[model samples]
Target: MTLSFELTQSVAILGGGPGGYEAALAAAQLGAEVTLVERAGVGGSAVITDVVPSKSLIATADAAVAIAEAGDLGVQLFAKGAHGKPLKPEIAINLAAVNKRLLTLARQQSDDMRAALVEAGVRIITGHGRLDSDNAVVVSTGPGGTDFDRVEADTLVVSVGASPRQLPSAMPDGERILTWTQLYDMTALPEHLIVVGSGVTGAEFAGAYMNLGATVTLVSSRERVLPGEDPDAATVLEKVFTRGGMTVLSKSRAEKVERSGDGVVVTLTDGRTVEGSHCLMAVGSTPNTRGIGLEEAGVQMDASGHIRVNRVARTSVPNIYAAGDCTTFVPLASVASMQGRTAVFHALGDVVIPLDRRRITANIFTAPEIATVGWQEKDVAEAHINGIVHKLPLAANPRAKMMGVRDGFVKLIARQGSGTVIGGVIVAPRASELIYPIAIAVERRLTVDQVSRVFAVYPSLSGSITDAARAMHHVERADED
Candidate 1:
């Protein structure tokens, strides 16, 4: 990548998210006067309310699970184990204190990022920003939102992000019926939690709550949870959920959520009713694209209202670019940052490569997290180039056996003739941490043999990664015979 080019133009970014701040820094580094306008403090929903908060909640749940399963490992502080009789210990969770810590950590991260941007000579404005006419931006501040502001820019980047989707039939009262972001406001664990829509967010919160001693019910409209993920991996996760005593109502769609006394009742399309102490609506998210004056500025948006952008993050209108969940692309914080940086490079006339979405690594933070990178098995043209799909279960790994872990595996997708690694999937505890090497292989266009030859630590879960790659190579060699 070029260090810098003729990128001396004025750049203005809207939203203080990963994409917006990253773009500001990149533009500033390229000798441009950069300014970032944000309504929230910094870090966007990813830090303030959504991603970081949920992950922190999951961490607490994981700790609870570790202690609950301590007996199975022959390490017990109590007389409860499979070696003896399973003891039922009443577990208590302080959700208020938990949420407080989560928010604290989130704010601290935002503050740290703010310090870095200020040090980088990027001007920060605390306000809601909107596009004005002809390469101009208007930022409004103050409690009344009447605070005046004007910004002149040679280029603009919009990364306003998205919010939780709300349904008319199932409106959230922020009490019994809640959105994902409102989960942190609880002071106690819900007795019977009904998670509607078993997507990644719904599944994660459902599993975490179940681990924390709550009786959980997951309502899914799809045939299985994580309908967008690999079917095999989704099956493994669904099995795990069932084994954990979660009531999975598959093919059930929520029609309405109503309050009954202090509890909530969810009505399904097929005349089924589910009652729970609290209802979590994880239907998906709507982009925060309304009232941003984007249409007036002539920036094109998709039918779903997400800004349309090219691989380099350029929008239909010249001098304007879009990134993050607000755009018509896959949403991830890492992808947003890369798109932002790419937009700055393109705007500044610097030599830069367009973002390759196929190389994007995605981690779904479930108990046994699902992580994948590059092209999938379905993506390979088997007729054109022979593709091999090799999977190695973690049960065969020494580490998994030692830890009494089961129900996850590593899968590799490769072209048998060329041995070129394309995609991989890891379905195990901490799979999120294991998908990097596969991503690197895809990025560098490494062969299966090359990945297999790399050394992974002995008696480790990661050994499955290289070992699976090696297994693919063996199959390829066998096909040659």
Candidate 2:
């Protein structure tokens, strides 16, 4: 297919993920002709497989958890076919329907994003796009990716996100051995699911399947699950996992995985073995930087294959930018969108505001979800950022008491000298939503006193957040006195 380049200023964005598509919309809004090239649909892995699918399944699992505790609150759950007769409560999950719903929700979200971009007058080309010489993008088209199209642009934005990193010894067959992306495709709940690499992804899935009534064995190479998260929160999660019939093996690294008599065995590096009906590897992700012509185009990248970009998302090559997981930065959907927008603004000659890494919030979507923003306790202890920390238990909140929540807390970090809200962490249900106010406080440089003054609903989980801030405010006052 032959198509002429737009005479007006055009931005060609590769990868229709959060970073790429968001940049396309922003550039289109900025009066630049934007064209987005993507092999997959819009919204990328966040909507397609990683974020949306996993979280949607987590919702189902969380509902099961809540229902399991309904009897304590005088709510009786009857079997659907019991005809009003009380029988033993059962949480029977339809794996086929669940997987179908997960995939449907993901594609629907991708469709919604695509419709928005189309409405914004962005031309979307379906293909694997790569940087070519002479300020152009070569899109590999047709059924077999042989036919191609050379598209012209004034500037280029590369936002192709990363993929699940595979191990040579333990290869995922997308059936017995699976990656996080293929987990939702299973037709049946694994009888004994063995999860390796207990990072955010592994912990979330392991907790979710356990809630869904699966026998789970969590293999953590580290001393505890979610090693990157807060120690207190990780401790709480590990406790919950162990209490919920999950067998957690700490400091055990899976060296090889093989099929053994219709089951999977994960042999540890220490010569130990874990056997299960299925296995999932949540090791990490590798950036999709190869064959994108990034290096040939003179774009700088770190040794680990992530593109090296500045605060404004500029690469080593002039007029070319890299954003999202493709760059060596925090892998958050929100952060990726901001990086994409920042790149588009700088490229389109608009006012450029560099991304603030400190103000970003990250959340792990396991039960009793953990969310954090701004300076961490380690950062303060290391003198990287000075902050006073105050923690309040969720059990102290009236709403938490009503909801029977007992295993979570809120921690607020305020600047030592100014008492300005610097960072905070929340370990509770919907902590993702809870972190927003803390993020706003940090972003606006609001003080602990100011945050505490903001009226939180009485007896609510938000009250715990405010209480933590109040505790810090009191400490600041006492220190000043």
Q: List candidate 2 segments past 4 Å from native.
A: 1-7, 79-85, 475-481
Q: Once model 2 is optimally superposed onto the true structure by TM-score, how far is the C-alpha of residue 282 displaced, in angstroms?
A: 0.4
Query: How many steric clashes between backbone atoms does each model show?
Result: 0, 0
TM-scores, in order shown? 0.95, 0.96
Write candidate 1's Cα lDDT for 417-439 as tens digits.
77788888999999999999999
Candidate 2 lDDT by residue in tens digits, 357-417:
8898999999989999988887877898767888888988899989988789999888886
Q: lDDT for every model?
A: 0.89, 0.89
In model 2, residue pairs whose N, Cα or C atoms come closer than 3 Å (at least 3 residues apart or on different chains), thus clashing, are none
User: Candidate 2 overall Cα lDDT vs. reference?
Assistant: 0.89
- The worst-scoring run of ten residues by lDDT in candidate 1 lies at 472-481
What is the alpha-carbon lDDT for the whole of candidate 1?
0.89
- Point to the candidate with the largest TM-score: 2
